[model samples]
Target: MKRVQAALQHFAQAVAAAMMAAMFLTFMLQIVVRYSARLEWLADRFPILNPSLYGWTLEFCLLLWIWLVFWGNAFVVRDRDHVTFDILFVTVRPAVRRWFIIISGISICTALVVSIEPTWAKFYILRLKKTATLSTIFGDWIRMRDIYSIYIFFLVAVALRYAWAVYRAVRFGVEEPVEAPAGQPTK
Candidate 1:
């Protein structure tokens, strides 16, 4: 299970990276085209007529941004690196801290599970709508639900991560995170 989770995390990270890169490229292309369009001489010389790839840039950047955010959340959860108001928790005894982790993790997992159905329904309804840029250009339009499905994946990954956290906290109690050397893996 750990291996599979790690593999999925890696895959999600790679996809998020690719999406970010593509978003950058498309945004740059929009900038170049917008500037080029300003110069009538250049516009005339170029084979392109409408130098407004703005729609495409906006659509894809937003699409990629949404995906990257949800996928990134899983990474944050995996590392237990989410925001902490540890002013109190940090001062507690080790036994108290373990209980805190377990309790919080269970709550998070429960919340995620409860959200799954409503989230799915909302995204499913989104499927009825087509993307303006991607669908229009591809001719074989993609549904909004397809783009929004990343949230579903995020919810599952996070729920699993938190569930694992709860299990570990229950089985081993509150333990400090192992701090490995810069280049070494934590045991």
Candidate 2:
């Protein structure tokens, strides 16, 4: 199970890296194409390099960015990687910290689960809306819903993650070791 999870984590990180690479390449293409219009020689040599030809690049980059953010947060980024104001949590006793984890995990899980339905409803409604450039490039098949679908995946992944954390907290007081403040002695 540990190996499987590690494999999944690596796969997810790879996917996120691929998305970032794609976005970078697309952005570079957009820049080159945009500037090519100002360079007559380049434009004449490669008429297809017209700035208008790569109009889809911006939209595509934006689409990839949306997926990258939600997908990375859901699968690639770990809980400890997130920023948190945990001064109170860290100051508390181990038992209180465990309770805090349980309560917060439950709250987060509940919020995410509850938002799923409304999120889906919005996505369903967005199915009718097509991206201006992407739809043209993809033969009108790419809808707003398709682009935003990663959000649903993010919600589900986070809810499940929190649920697992809550379960672990119940079974074994907070699994993470609380970091002591500066000058503080080890408990």
Candidate 3:
């Protein structure tokens, strides 16, 4: 179980890194083309006429952003990196802290379950209608909008992982370390 969780964490981190790189490269390329004299002619030929004009670049970048953010969130949950005001808990007994964490985790899981289906259905409708800003064999047929499904996928993954973490906390009564804020002493 630990190995599986560790693998998932690593995979999410790698995917996030790749997505970030892709987004950065796409934006940088656009910037250079717009600003650099050497690329002026090329830019003029392929002016940013509209969101549609960027075609795959825009769609792919948007998808990458969604994936990166979602996956990064999953990573955060799996690693228990989400922010919290645990100062109050610090004074409480460990048993109470464990129960509190479990409650919070269950709440998060409920929210995710409630939201995921509706959100996914909305995306599915958009995809089914072949909705897109740009029309092309590559964009329309391949349907870049379908990529939005990844958002739902990652959200579900994160929710499940978090729920599992909560269960582990409740059953095993383990409290992961909390990092001290900047300039604060380690407890």
Which regions of candidate 3 are displaced past 4 Å?
1-4, 36-56, 76-80, 129-137, 142-145, 176-187
Query: How many residue-pair clashes does candidate 2 contain?
Result: 0
The residue pairs that clash in candidate 3, if any, are none
Residue-level lDDT tens digits of model 2 in 5-104: 9999999999999999999999888878876778888877877886667878989999999999999999998877787787898787889989998999
Total backbone clashes of candidate 1, pairs 3 or more residues apart or in separate chains: 0
User: Which residue pairs show collisions in model 1?
Assistant: none
TM-scores of all predicted structures: 0.83, 0.91, 0.73
How many Å off is the CA of 58 in candidate 1? 0.9
lDDT, each prediction: 0.80, 0.88, 0.69
lDDT of 1 by residue, 1-187 (tens): 9999789778877877887898889888888887777788887777564565356667878888998898788663346455556678767888998989888999999999999999998787897898887755656558888889988888998898889989998898876656679977555
Which residue runs of candidate 1 sit more than 4 Å off their true CA positions? 1-9, 52-54, 76-80, 177-187
Query: Which 10-residue window of candidate 2 scores lowest in summed lDDT?
Result: 178-187
Candidates 2 and 3, the one with greater TM-score: 2
Sort by lDDT, best first: what order? 2, 1, 3
- Reference-based TM-score, model 2: 0.91
How many Å off is the CA of 61 in candidate 3?
2.6
lDDT of 1 at 13: 75
